[model samples]
Each structure stands twice: as structure tokens, then as C-alpha cells.
Target: MGDFIDVEQLYDLAMTYSVKLLQALLLLIIGLIIIKRLTSFLRKRFERRKLDPSVRSFLLPGISLSLKILLGISIATMLGAEMTSFVAIIGSIGFAVGLALQGSLANFAGGLLILVLKPYKVGDYIETKDHSGTVNEIQIFYTTLDTPDNKRVIIPNKELSNSSLINYSINKTRRVDFKFGISYDDDIKLVKDILNNIVSSHSLIIQEPEPKIVIGEHGDNAIIFYVRVWCKREDYWTIFYELQERVKLDFDQNNINIPYPQMDVHVSNS
Candidate 1:
């Protein structure tokens, strides 16, 4: 009889633990679903706010991880596990992992600075060191660029943040500077008039700032005329190539001489 009573108590104990375990599992499953939905909601909110891509990329993962950690703690508590020791162990592990990833930590910090400071953003044409391209993506550790020739470049965020970079797309307009050389004997007035006409005729060039055509310098073989014009950033390359071709063609048609280096050497033997 006593053995039967003991068996009944044992079964009750096992049943109680089984129920708690199932409850813990259910809580974990529901918690994960909530975390996923919450993270997605936050991501959409960030997109609506027009947050920087880098910031959004860094933040979403962090939010998910933080929520999961909290959920894990809650699950452990529900399972009758001690919280203090579990948190301490987690902290120790995190510290050890952080110590092992110093370089990665620096990159993470650099990425944060880039997002906050707004040095460059996705779709911006940027040049850093010797690499120049359009920024395609910015992540926690690297920035991806699409080069003019369709090459993909991956630059480390740490190096990019520390170095100087030129963001060419920051402004809506750009100035195109061209230097043309003509023979020293060429008529200065005629050259200026020809350039002015070309500038006025070009549909891409802006007239508000006014195109500048002036004698810049006198070289050994030619006179240099500096030409400056403003155009929309999108039209810069087109205008540059067109201007050069048109100027050369017009100069040739008008009988203007573009001087090249020539040496007249005479030797006398006595």
C-alpha cells in the first residue's frame, strides 16, 4: 500500500514537470513569432521614415537579437531556472567574444558613424583613395559599390570612415572645366567668339552662372584658353565629350591652328 502511495506521488511530480515544460515550449514558440512580427513592423516604420539604409541595416538585426535574448531569459525563468547565474554566464561569453573580435567591433563602430554623420549614402557617386563608384549598399562591416564598368567593389567600413571621400552626387549641378590650346598667332577675339557661340548653342549648358572663356596662360607652343561651364550633374559627361568634339571640329572648320610642339634646329659646320 505504501509503495502504491509513493508511486502515485512520483507520477504527480512527473506530470507537474511535464506540464511546465510544455508551457515553456509554448511560450518560446509564441515569443519567437511575436519577435519576428515586431521586427518586421519596425523595419517598415523605418522605411516610411526614410531612415538611412546603413542605420536600418544595423538596427534591425540588433533589435531582433535583443528581443530574442530577453525572450530566452523569460523562458528560462518560466522553466524554474535561476536568472542571475544565466545572465552572468551570458555576459562572460559576450565579453570573451567581443575581445576576440576587436577589428569587427571597430568596423561596427565605423558603420555607426557613417550612418549618423551621413558622409555618403546609397546611390551616391563617391571616390575614396583610388576607388570611385556608386554606392550600392552599406552594411555593418562593408560598403558595396558598383563601378562605372559594372564591377562590384567591397570596401571595409572602417577604412572608408577614416579616409577622405568625395561625394560627387551631393550637389545637383557640376562645373565642367576645359582647357583648349591654339597657336600663339591665332586671333584672341576670334577664338573667344567661337567658344561663346559653341557654349550658347549647346542645349545642356546652363546660362545662369554664365560660361567663362578667357586666356588662361601662354605656353611655349600654344595659347591656353580656359573654358568653364555649369551643367546638371547627370549631363556632365555628355556635355564634356560633346564640347571637346565640337570645339575641335569648329576650330578646324574655321581655319584656327592648334599648335603642337615643334623644334626648328639648324646646325652650321665651319
Candidate 2:
């Protein structure tokens, strides 16, 4: 009878431990789900606040991951588990992982720098390392650019922030300069007048600067005229394309000859 009682007590103790283990697991799962939902809610709230997209992308993911880890640790403690040893183990592992991912960490830091610096905004036209494109999106590791040829290029934030960046849309207006050459025989005054008339007639051209046209140079076979105009940034492309077309047509109608390269070839017969 004494041996049977001891066996029964051992069995009851095993059952109690198993039940506690199961409850701990359930608590962990519920905690994770709640963290997920709360993180999502915070993200949406930040978005509604019109936070910078680049900032929000990294901020939300980082905060959520941190919160989930903390909650999991809390749940573990409630299950009467010793956490100090586990935390020490995680700390050592994290140090090793961080060393292995140093380059990725550098990129993430660069991305944060870009978000804070505000060198260029979304939809801004920029040139970096000879690659010209419009910024489509900025992310934690990389930035997306849409090229003029409709190509999507992903550039690492590390390179982007480190390199020189040229932003074209920084100002509300931009200057467009065009040089046209005419036959030396054409009157310089007449050429200037034609360019001036065209500039003034263009609707997109800004009048404050008062477009300037002057004789630039006298080439071997032609005379050059420099035409400078200013227009709004949004109208830059339209003004550029239209001015080229109109200048060619007007020059032709006025009998102005844009010089073309001519080579004199000599053949010798022996």
C-alpha cells in the first residue's frame, strides 16, 4: 500500500507539470497574435498621420519585432521559468549574428540618414553616379528609381547616401539653354530677333528673367546664337521639345541654314 501511494503521487506531479507547459505554450501563441494585431494598428495610425513613408517603413517593423520579443519573454517568466540564462544565451547569439550582418547594418543606417536628411523627395528627378531617374520609393535597404526608359533600378542606400546626388526639381523653375548655328552669311541681328520672338511667344516660358539671345561664336562654316529661357519645372520637357520643333520650322521659313559638316575629298589617279 505504501509503494502504490508513492507511485500515485509521482504521477500527479507529472500531470501538473505537463499542464503548466501546455498553458505556457498557449500564452505564448496568444501573446504573439496580440502583438501582431497591435503592431498593425500602430502602423495604420502612423500612416494616417501622414508620416514620411521612408521613416514609417523601418519604424513599424522594428517596433513590432521589439515588442513581440519583450512579450514572449514576459510570458516565459509567468510560466515560472528562469530567464536570466536564456537572455544571456540570446545576447551572445545576437552579438555573433550582428557581426556577421555588419554590411546590412551599414545599409540600414544609411537609409535612416537619407530619411532624416531629405536630400530628395519621392517623385523627384535626380542623378546619382551618372544614372538619372525619378525616385519611386525609398526603403530600408534600397531605393527604387524609374528611369526615363521605363526601367526600374534598385540602388542600395549605402551607395546612394555616400555618392553625390543631383536633384533637378529642387526649385520651382529651371533654365533651358539652346545653341543654334546658322550660315555665317545670315545676319546676326536677324537671328537674334527670330529667337527673341519665339521665346516671347512661348506660353510656358517665364517672363521675369526676360529670355536672352546673343551671338555666341563664329564657327568655321556657321555663326552660333545662344538662346536662354526659363520655365516652370513641370513645363520643362514640353518647353524643350516644342522649342526645338518651332525653331527648326521658323529657321527654315526664314531661310536660315543650320550648317552641316562638309568634307572635301580629293581622288588622285596615277
Tens digits of per-residue lDDT for model 1, 1-270: 999999999999999999989999999999999999999999899999998776787788878988998998898888887889888988999999999998888888888899889898888999999799999988888888999999999988899999999999999999999999999788889999999999999999999898899999999889999999999999999999999999999999999998887889999996
Best by lDDT: 1
Model 2, poorest ten-residue lDDT window?
A: 52-61
lDDT against the true structure, each candidate: 0.92, 0.86
The residue ranges of model 2 lying beyond 4 angstroms of the native Cα positions read 1-36, 71-81
Prediction 2 TM-score vs. true: 0.83
lDDT score, candidate 2: 0.86
Q: Any runs in candidate 1 off by more than 4 Å, and if so which?
A: 1-33, 72-81, 261-270
Q: Clashing residue pairs, candidate 1?
A: none
Write model 2 residue lDDT over 140-249, tens digit each, in one string.
77888899999999888888888899999889999999989999888777778888899999989999888888888888888888888999999999999999999999
TM-score of 1: 0.81
